[model samples]
Target chain A: MTACVIMGSGNIGTDLMYKVLRSYTLDLRALVGIDPDSEGLHRAADMGVDTSASGVKWVIDNADSINLVFEATSAGIHRSHAPEYERLGITAIDLTPARIGPSVVPGVNLKDHLEAPNVNLITCGGQATTPIVAAICRAASVPYAEIISTVASNSAGPGTRANIDEFTETTSACLEEVGGAGIGKAIMILNPADPPIMMRNTVYCGLADGYDPERVVESIVQTVDNVRTYVPGYQLKRAPVFENGPFATPGGVVQTRVVVLLEVSGAADFLPAYAGNLDIMTAAAVRVGEALGAARTGGRT
Target chain B: MTAAFRLTDSTLRDGSHAIRHQFTVDQVRAVVRGLDRAGVEVIEVAHGDGLGGSSFNYGFSRIDEMDLIRAAVDEADNARIAVLLLPGIGTKDDLVHAANIGASVARIATHSTEADISHQHMALAKDLGMETVGFLMLSHMVASGDLLDQAKRMESYGADAVYVVDSAGAMTIRDTMERISMLKHGLDCGVGLHAHNNLSLAVANSLAAIGEGIDQVDGCLIGLGAGAGNCPTEILVAACDKAGYETGIDLTELLDVATDVVRPLSPNQGVIDRDGLMLGYAGVYGSFLLHAKRAAEVYGVACDDILLELGRRGIVGGQEDMIIDVALELRQAADSSDAPR
Candidate 1:
């Protein structure tokens, strides 16, 4: 089994460690964090995985057994650590918005980038919405797509808060680069409601004149189903809503516009079910990691 | 105790809601030029919901917000271009795009109790070297002490100023005084107020907030905004001038803009209609006025009932979808009662 090490013991890192521990194809190596007092490190120790406070440097020093590195640190930290992971020949699955590697949304285009040295799981918003964008693009000529992702306030960690700029830039870039939209805009909301709400996404895509809504809806449903494979909690909050437009588009007036609403409930592995933002990211990372690991093992027992 | 006050013209931003997000590019250019000539320090331009907010749910913008921002920036020679960004409605990328197009200031807003969410956006705006204001909408929903706590969070997040936004237009003189005074006392950054004229008190409340040492205040030309409308920039400037406060705004130019540029664009003059007054009385969010109206029509319920029920339930911004659900419930209850026993 390909052994994996999760670097950073924050919310995303801890959740990823839990996901990695349960993966049948990838073995959990260690949970590395800078804070020795972090509860994530203690939880890892309790789960019988090796724990360290030395962070990625320690992971590199002991790189013999680790084949994959999950870099869950901040975007700035990931920028420095990415090249080191590359030099050490350890495949890094980055959870930060650093975008050091090609962006991958597993449900949409994971197989295309499996052989790459490093893969970025974009932002939580990208992971949740891009697949749907990709689906629409596959069926029609999408001129512009905009997404708004709202997650519970409590679910946002310091890392998530600090990387807000990267989250929007990287997610919007990936919508064009990976999801194949002509132009993309991303918005993120942190809902501070008590009994914290689940992660919800609103995706709006502008279609060229005379495009078929039925065909577009079919493609979107297929993509939603594909995402549900890894993220069982993911579901369409409502069916795709289409509007005939005098709506302004980058390429003049659009014939039709499509709106799709999505919600993600967490599996409650580490964080609460409200933290579907973290769940979707970690879940996508696991799907990508296991697929890469399985390819390396050639499906051998 | 007199302090120099900065005036923000939000006719292009908040006023978009009053017009159903249909502000044309030509309109933005004209209004912006007028506001700049009138000596308004800041001119905010975007979809009423902010950048990246043109969608079916929020009501699509007739023109893309970026194009409007570019137009406003091109027209305004002296006024600093600003944009109101609800954290969830617009992102840092949108801010970057706005800044690139010469938007010099960003009001990063959130629900009053959710100021923590503005931290990242505020930090990003600061890093980009733009003047940042943390805006707490629906300030009436929280107590003065709680509002102070939220304002302090924004101040800590690198905001140059923090605003107590009466998004519902629900604050009275007492409400404004207690909250603004507490914020002025507790926060290290500058204090600002954004008032809605739902109760025809936008000017009165602005005066009260100014009395409590608010450094900046927002208004729209001709009082064009959500609910009854925002504080009318022209009227507020006149009032400030009469009260012996210095606003640095030209009353003559503001009057021309209000009469010529803004008034023609407004669908109706900004006045306290029943729905508008009910918003202030019910303490509902100003932005929710349109959404609640639509839901009221869809579910065959009175808009007033929806507003009152939403206020009772403590619905806040980002919960726009709840308007429909509440309207539906209200309709269903009414239906059951109307049926034969």
Candidate 2:
């Protein structure tokens, strides 16, 4: 089994630790953070995993046995630690927007970047929207794609709050680099509702005039099915809506525009189900980590 | 009174809704330059709904808002370029792009009761070294006490200022005085007001807010905006000047822009019509005026009923879809009533 260590003992790190513990191929080694009083580290210790408050240095010192390190820290910290992980020959799965490695959206482009030393999960918004963007592009020539991801306010932790700018830039770049869109725009919303709402994403893709709407819808359904393999809670809240003919854009009239609404219901592994934003990120990380571990084990397990 | 105040021009941003989000680059340059020359402190540019708001749902922009923003930024010499961003409609990335392209200020808007959502964007704006303003849209929907609570949340989130946006132009002079006075007393940062002219009280309400020591106020050139349009910049500046208030704006220059550039582009004179007045009476969102009208036609219901029902439900911005849903239900109710027993 491939040994994995979770860095940053916050909501995301703690949730990731729980998923790693349940992984058949990945053995949870330790949870590391800078705060000694962090609930995540305490919970990890209680769950029988090694815990440290010394941060990434602890993971590096004990890198001898660790095959994978999940960096759940902010973008700035992740940038400083990524080279260290590479030098130590430990594969890093970055959940931050440092973009130290190629962007990986498991359902769409995981296989393309499996051999890289480090891979970025982009942001939760990217994970939730890029697959659909890619799906639309696969069926038609999409010139522009914009996604608005609305998550419950309570679900967004300090880390998510602190990295809002990085989240947008990284997510938009991924939509183009990974999702195959000519231009990409990303918007995030933290809905402050009582009994916090589930994570919802609205995706708008502008296609050239005369593209087949049926083929595009089929591609989207296929992509949604693939993403559901790892994120079971991920599903279309409604069918894709389409508008035809000369729709006005800054870049001129598009032949067709498609609007897709999506929702992610968390598995409620560690955090509540309303935190589908957090759940999708951690779940996608686990899926990628397992794929890497299986590859290392010669696909035996 | 010698109390300094900042004036923001929303001709290009909020005004986009009136023109169906089709502000050409030349139009933006003309309007922004005119506002800049008039010594306006801040000029906002974007889709009427804000950045990333160009979608099939929100009327798609004739030109990309970023292009409009860039044009406005390039045209302005002394005025700070600001952009309005409803958190759900515009993302942090859009803010970064705006800043990179020369936008110096961001007005992060949310519903009056949902100020907590502004924390992320406001924090990011401060981190990026850009001035941040929290805009609470549909301000008339909540009480002054509730508004104070929401404004305090924005101040704690690193907003340099918080605005009471009369999104529906629904506030009276008394409503403005109570809310702005309470915010002025409660907030550590500056308090601002954004009024629509739906009630024909935009100038009067703004004057009342200024009387309550509001540090900032917003207006659009020639009142070119959604609904009955915004407070007319020239008239507001002229009125402020007459009231012994110091806005530092060149009234003559503002008036010239209103007549020469903005007045020509206005689709209709900024006057309160039956539908526009209903927005104020019902306390509905100003931007929802056009959406409600379209939905009313599509669903075969009275537009006035949609606005009234939406207000009663306390529906806020970012809930545009609900407009159609409400209209459909109203249509069904009417259909059942007309059917044979």
Candidate 3:
């Protein structure tokens, strides 16, 4: 198994640990955090995984054995650690909004960026929506794509709250570079509903005049299916709806487009099922870890 | 001597929400020309959701807000052009363009509890060498102390002034006095108050805020705004005149602008209909009125029920997507209740 270090022990890092524990091609080396008394590290230790309160320094010392590092920490932390990981010759699968590396949504550009030192997994909204935008772009030229991501308010902490602008900037940029849209807009909503809702995304692709609806739907479904293989909970809420629009955007006019609604339910590895935001990140991380690990071992995925 | 305050005419910004954000260049020029002639100090203009806010979720703008801002600037004699920006919805690029386009002020808005999100935009506006205001939307949702903490955060981020926005139109006169007093006491920057009339308290709340020594206040010509509309510019000027506040606005001219400019745009903007009243009663954001009505109709759900449910969920501004979600759930609940147990 390819040994790896999960560099954060928050909900995301802990969730990544549980997901790695189940991976056949990946080995969980340890979960690390800065706070010595962090509950996340204690719970990880209870599960018999090696844990660290030493944070990034521990990852640096242990870099000799680690094949990959999943940076589940804040974007600032990942940004500081990115070049460090690069110098140490370790591949980092960044789950933060830091755009230091090329954006990767596994189903869309995973193999393309494997040789690179670090790859950003954008935000959960980006991983969930970019592929579908890319799919529609394949069938029809998407001039403008906008994605609205709504998650449980309870799940969003002050960190997430503070990074709203970064989240939008990063996700929208990925929709263009990876999803192939000419213009991309990202919006996030923190829903205050009790018994929190699943992480949901609404994607609207403003199509050019001559695109075919049948081809667009076909392309989107195929892409969603490809995503489900890695994320068992990724789902389309309904068939794509087409509406004639006079959608006067800041970019330009969108005469016609399709709207796709999606919801992601978590696998409940380390958190509740409603936290599909965290689940999609961990699932994508494991998928990347296994892929990179196989690339290293020259074995089957 | 009476208390004096600066007047901000949102007949162009907030008024866009009442008319579905379809303000043409001509309308903007007409209103800005009139308000500017009447000695109004600031004319806030943009798509109702703010700069760069035209989208599928917030509904698109007819004339680009930039072109509209240009028209307002060209026609104005004295009033400075101000643009409202919801931090994530309108990025720093928008602020730069508005500044380049001769807009004089930037009002960066965020939910009261989410003031930290505006740090970058507020600082960026200042960095662009333009004046900026921190607009705290849905101020009634938080306590006075919490609201002041948010205002202080904005002040630290370089806000020249901070405004408590009653996006819900739900605050009482006392609620208005308490929040504004805390902000005025805690903040070193200028303080302003924006009120909606969903509870028929728009003018009263503004008067109360003025009593708390407010620095600025907003009004719409004919009260042309979302929900039951905002405080009427004509009425506020007249009331301030009676209350001995030197607003510096020409009352007859302001009324003429209200009658000839805004009233034509929203002739029925004065009446507080059922949806308008419910918005205040439920303490829902005023902008949610139109979206919720559309959602209620699409799902065959009662608008009042949806508004109350949204209030119960503690919905805030910028979370407009939840209106559809709540409507769909309400529809499902309605369908299940119709079935045999």
The residue-by-residue lDDT of candidate 1 on B1-341, one tens digit each, is 43378888899999999888988888889888888887787999998887767765577788788999999888988998999888766777788899998998999988887787688788889999999998998899889999999889899989999999999899998999999999999988999999999988899999988888889999998889888899998999899889988888889988987898788776476768899999999988888888888777766899999999887766667566556557757877898999999
DockQ scores for all predicted structures: 0.27, 0.20, 0.47
CAPRI level of candidate 1: acceptable
- TM accuracy, model 3: 0.91
Specify the CAPRI tier of model 3.
acceptable
Q: Pick by TM-score: which candidate is best?
A: 3
Arrange candidates by TM-score, highest first: which order?
A: 3, 1, 2
Q: Decide which is better by TM-score, 2 or 3.
A: 3
* lDDT over C-alpha atoms for residue B30 of model 1: 88
User: What residue pairs clash in candidate 1, if any at all?
Assistant: A188-B88, A189-B88
Please name the candidate that would achieve the greatest lDDT relative to the true structure.
3
Query: How would the candidate models be sorted by lDDT, starting from the highest?
Result: 3, 2, 1
lDDT of each: 0.85, 0.85, 0.87
Q: Write the per-residue lDDT of candidate 3 for residues B88-175, one digit (tens) a residue.
A: 6787778889999899899989888778778888888888887889999888888999999989999999999999999999999999
Positional deviation of residue A58's Cα in model 3 after best superposition, in angstroms: 3.5
Off by over 4 Å in 2: A248-252, B1-6, B25-43, B49-60, B63-161, B168-175, B186-189, B197-201, B234-285, B291-341
The number of residue pairs in model 1 that clash at the backbone is 2
Q: Evaluate residue B229 in candidate 3 and report its C-alpha lDDT on the 0 to 100 scale.
A: 96
